[model samples]
Target: MSETTEKDLYAVLGASPSDPVQELRRRYQQLALQYHPDRLGNECSSEAESGVKKFLEVDAAWRLLSDQSTRRQYDLQRRARELKQDWPVDSTVCLDDMTWDEDDCVYTHSCRCGGRFSITEEELEEETQRKQEDVGEKEKEEEQHREAVVCCDTCSLSVYVIKDVKS
Candidate 1:
């Protein structure tokens, strides 16, 4: 999920990743008690419904954070996601905007830093294959899409390449 639109489990329980287990448990208990559906009464009021949702979120947060292995995995994945999103994109260029080197089987775009940003046709094909292999049998989704980031050969600048599936 996109970071901006995605919900943060830590924020759900008013806890941080670095917080101690005791602190997390304390925050989780506080939130659980505050949002427990049982305390909201029998009436199907909007507040009660919202409380139920909050309670479920709190419970889920606790489930992931309470386990040592699961917590480590979650932290690693979150860090990778943040690192992926933190990179600065020098520009966004379409695959067609690049010059194709038929001999090298690579597409190249000129960077403002005077370094070349290049991606090979084989690399793109390999990425598509990797994504296809990653699809689960239970997931019947048919759409296939992936991003190809091309970094400058001589500089830290990177270009976001948008490859046209038809191109």
Candidate 2:
């Protein structure tokens, strides 16, 4: 019923958007360290509270986006937001993937695509494995080609092209 802006978690954490997972965690730790209330003195209670709030937000965002399933749900939410931005007149599409966990204050997506058209995390992993196997096979073929040289008799020129093309 209500909508919120899909924030860039990296922006929240004040880190580079393109940072790797390790880098992201490191950045979040650094920022969290800076905002930690234990380090704050009595002189700046308001500032400390604000910092803590921001740090919590950053940490929460990072936690959500770091995990595969949660990140996917967030991504879907972000895509929906982008669509809304592009077409202001269009009604909001219900992406009922997220369900709030009361204690954690985080949303857990109930990733049910319905009927036989479901795309589960297991399916994604299988697909990824398939792709990796395909890549490995292609790489092996390339390595074999690299070891063997092809010389053109007409030009007396030898060239090694990794890309197999029908000429």
Badly placed stretches (over 4 Å) of model 1 are 1-6, 86-167
RMSD to true structure for each model, in Å: 8.5, 22.9
Candidate 2: Cα lDDT at 158: 33
lDDT of 1 by residue, 25-116 (tens): 99999998899988888979888898998898888888888888988888887775664574688788878879998888889988777889
lDDT of 2: 0.50
Q: How far is candidate 2 from the true structure (C-alpha RMSD, Å)?
A: 22.9
Per-residue error (Å), model 1, residue 149: 10
lDDT (Cα) of model 1:
0.77
lDDT of 2 by residue, 97-141 (tens): 334456754333321222111223343344344434546976644
What are the lDDT scores of the predictions, listed in order? 0.77, 0.50
Error of 2 at 16 (Å): 5.3
User: Could you estimate the TM-score for every candidate?
Assistant: 0.51, 0.44
Model 1 poorest ten-residue lDDT run: 137-146
